[model samples]
Structure formats: structure tokens, C-alpha cells
Target: MGPTRVRDLSVAAVAVAALGYAVVTLMYRHFPPITALSGMSLAVVALAEAGWGFYVRAQIKDGHIGIGGGRLHPLVVARSVVVAKASAWVGAGVLGWWVGVLIYLLPRRSTLRVAAEDTPGAVVAACCALALVVAALWLQHCCKSPEEPPDDAEPAAE
Candidate 1:
């Protein structure tokens, strides 16, 4: 399969943002208060993915096809790619959701006590989601094999 497209992610984010905004607008009063740390889980995942990406890149660069002296299965890389793609999409959607909520909340922060209190959490969440997207993309890139020169290319003179 081809790499994940930014345009597709963008569309998904926009759609989800609209939906999230509508839901929040209609049911915000019934929802519990957002805590400042509510979105930190995503950040943790992002850090893990980034670390994995570095490890994968190192293993591949060293021409070692294994984990800790064992052969690295092709499926592992494929699975990593899938996970990265999925995480990127999820992150985009979440980022969009937070942005939408911020759009609604920021203007009312001055007039609404709840909105004021929730703004910091939303901002934090949005940043974490963005980090996830970046880390996932990095992981996906690290999983790619190096490119080979084309057969028709001329050899350089010694």
C-alpha cells in the first residue's frame, strides 16, 4: 500500500472537527469538566512511537534484520507501518476535534467560567495530538527501505 496522504488526513480531520463541534455544542453542559492532564496519554504514545522509529532506523541502517540477534520479520515492519498510519489518522482527527472545541470555547472564555477553565486542557490536548501525528509519520518513514539506483543509470568514472 502507498504511504498515507496528507490530504486524506486533512479531510478526515475537518469532517471529525465538524462532527465534534456539533456534539460539543449540543451536549457540553452534560459533559464532565476537562482536566488539564486528560490528553497526556497521547503524548506518551507519541514518545514511544518516536523511540521505536529511531530503533527501527538504526537496525535497518546496520543491515541487521532482527531484534536482539534474532531475524527481524518483514511482518513486523509492515505492522509498524500500519500502526503508524492508523495513529497518524487518529491524531489528525483528535487534533481537529480539539481545534473545533477551542474555536467554540475561546470566544466564550471571558463570559463563561467553564470555557475559561477548559481552555488550557484543550490546548494541551491539541498539542499532544499534533505530536502523535509527527511521531507516527516519522515511524512510517523509518520503515521504508532504502532506494536503489535505476538499472539504466550510468556508472561514474573512477
Candidate 2:
């Protein structure tokens, strides 16, 4: 499979953002308040992926980890790539969702106590989502084989 492209991620984000906005707008009166903990799961995933990426990169670069009985498994790398791509897409979607919520709440904050209180949580969630995107992208990059050409580059002469 190919690497995740920014265009695809952007499209996903936009679509999710629009949906989030519509849902929140339609159900604002009955919607539960967004709490800072809403993004805790995402935060944990982001941290784990980022840390794993660094570890994999270091091991692969050493040349000792991927050899003998201690060989770095190819399946692990492939799975990491898949996870990174999925995480990036999911993160983008969440970020867009929070942005939608913020857009809906900002103007109403002054007159709506709930809006004012929820704004902080939404903002934090948005930031964490953004961080997840970055972390996932970094993990994807780290997972690449050193000898492989970049997705956008022309093939080298044989």
C-alpha cells in the first residue's frame, strides 16, 4: 500500500468537520458538555506511537536489531505504518470536529455559561488532536526503510 497523502487527510478532515458542525448545531441544546478528558484516549495513543517510532528508528539504524534472532520484524514495521496512517486520519477528523465545536461556541460564550465552560475543553481537545497528527506522521516517517525512495520522488537509476 502507498503512504498516506495530505490531500486525503485534508478531505477527511473537512468532511468530518462539516458533520461535527451540523451535529452540534442541531443538538446544541441537549448536547453534553465537552470535557478535557474527552481527548485522553487520543493523547495516550499519540504518546505511545511517538515513543515507539523513536525506538524503532533507533533500533533499525543500529543494524543490530534487525539481524539474527533479534531481527526487527517486517510485520511490525508494516503494522506501524498502518497504525500511523489510520491515526493520522482519525486525528485530523477529531481536530476538525473540535474546530467545529469551537466555531459554534465562541460567539455564544458570553451569553451561554455552558458554552464558556465547554470552550476550554474543546480547545484542549483540538490541540491534542493536532499533536496526534504530527506524532503519527513522524511515526510513519520513522517506519520507512532507509533504502526506499520517498513517495513523491522519482525512482533512482538501477
Candidate 3:
């Protein structure tokens, strides 16, 4: 499969963000507060993904940093690409969701104490989601074959 495109991710994020904003707007009274624990969890995921991306990049370029034989197999690189694509999609959705939450809460913060308190957590969550997307995209790029031409390049005639 091809690498994850930014255009696709942007569309998905916009769609998800609109949906999330609508849902939260309609049911904000029942919404729970954004806790520090939840923010920490998102940060943990971001950190892990970033570390994995670095490791994958090293493996793909160097092929001498992994376990055992210190060489990355082709299948492993393919699988990593798949994981990166999936992670990008997931991260975009999550980022959209948190952004929706922030949009709804930011204006109401003056009147709603909970909203004011939760704003920081929502911001943290959104940033972490963005980090995940970056890490995933980097991993996908690392998986690309060095000899392959750029996407804009025309193919040679047979």
C-alpha cells in the first residue's frame, strides 16, 4: 500500500472534528472533566510512538542496529509501514476530537468552572495527538526505498 497522504488525514480530521464538536455541543452538560491522568496517558503514547519512529528510521537506513543479526528484513519494514499508516489515521481522529473539545470549552470557560479547569488537559491531549501524527508520518517516510524516485517524478518508458 502507498504511504499515508496528508490530504487524506486532513479530511478525516475535519470530518471527525465536526462530528465531535456537534456531539459535545449537544451533550456538554453530561461531559466529564479532562483529568491530568488522561493527559498523561496521551503523553505516554506520544513518547512511545516517537521512540519507535526513531528506532524504525535507524533500522531502515542503517540495517545494523537491531537485535540478533542487526539487519532489518523486508517484511518487517512493510509491516512497520502499515503500522505507521494506521497510527496516523488514529492520531488524526484523536487530535480532531480533542480540538473539538477545546473549541467548545474555551468560550464557555468564563461561565463554567469545569471547562476552565479542563482546558489545559484538552490542550495537552491535542498536542500529544499531533506528536503521534508526526511520529507516524516520519516512520512511514523511513520505510520508503531509498532508490525510489520522488512521487512527482514521471516513470521511465519500458
Candidate 4:
């Protein structure tokens, strides 16, 4: 019972956090552009979230009780989560690629300068940097298979 309660609380917290994050992002929509570090950070955060989201989603799939009162299966949930992650990566990648192109085409000044001077452009550029970060992360980690035989090399029973 305690464990379940804790899980519920944690899930609730994540939900609220996600909402707050969205709101903050929206509020900042009119602001100056993001810095290189910040852009990279956003991508890092998204990648981390997507990965952890898949895990939480997988847990939710593995079955317990939904906050809404329903039975669930981890496999199905994980598959859906995996698809979402893939989609996010794709979008981030394309967007980032374009942003990078723009940045490259821009003048000798820093991205931060451009972002502060032109919010929309900066935002797009920041997003591009993030996409690149995500792509790097994906290249490094996304293709890995979670399952593998143990090093002992014991054959499974027939």
C-alpha cells in the first residue's frame, strides 16, 4: 500500500512538473532567443525525459492500477512510448538540422546575440541545437538493445 501510494505521488509530481514546464516554455515564447548551453540543455532534458518517460510508461504498462482505475499492460505501453520517443527524435532532428543551417548562415556573432536580437530566430536556432544534441544522444544510446545474454554463456534449457 505504501509503495503504491508513493508511486502515485511520484507520478502526480511528474505530471505537474511537465505541465509547469510547458507553461514556462509558453510564457517564454515571446522572449529573447536561447543560448547554446540552454539549447543543448533542452535537448538533453528532452532526451532524458523521453528515456525516463519510456521507462515510466513501461512501468505503467507492466500493470498495477492506473490513477484512473484500470488495468494496464507494460508491453503495450512501452511500445507506444517507444513510438512516441522515435517521433520526438525525428522531429527534433529535422528541426535541429534546419536551425543549424540557419546558424551557419548567420553572421559571425554568437547565437545568444541573435536570439536576444530576434526572438523567433533565436528560438528556432536554440531548438536546432537541441535537436543536434538529441541526435547525438540517440546515436550514442538509442540503438542499444536492453536485453542480452549473460557473460557466463549458460545455454537456456530447451
The best candidate in terms of lDDT? 1
Per-model CA lDDT versus the true structure: 0.89, 0.87, 0.81, 0.45
Per-residue lDDT of candidate 4, residues 1-158 (tens digit): 01112243335434544554455345544534444443445466556555755555454445452454554444544454455445444445444433443443344345445434554454554565445434433433433334655777777789
Estimate candidate 1's RMSD in Å.
Answer: 2.9
Give the least accurate 10-residue stretch of model 1, judged by summed lDDT. Answer: 64-73
How far is 118's C-alpha from truth in model 3 (Å)?
A: 1.1
Q: Which parts of model 1 are misplaced by more than 4 Å?
A: 66-68, 150-158
lDDT of 3 by residue, 37-107 (tens): 65566567667767776776777667453446757767777887888899899999998898888899999
Give per-residue CA lDDT, model 1, range 32-105, as digits (tens).
Answer: 88777978999999999999999888877777665566656778888999999999999999998998888889
In model 3, the worst 10-residue window by lDDT is 59-68
Which sequence of candidate numbers ranks them by TM-score, best first? 1, 2, 3, 4
In model 2, the number of clashes is: 1
Question: Where does model 3 exceed 4 Å of error?
Answer: 63-68, 148-158
Root-mean-square deviation of Cα positions for candidate 4 versus the true structure, in angstroms: 14.3
lDDT of 1 at 31: 75
User: Considering only N, C-alpha and C atoms within 3 Å, which residue pairs clash in candidate 2?
Assistant: 66-72
In terms of lDDT, the poorest run of 10 residues in model 2 is: 59-68
lDDT of 2 by residue, 87-114 (tens): 9999999989988888899999999999
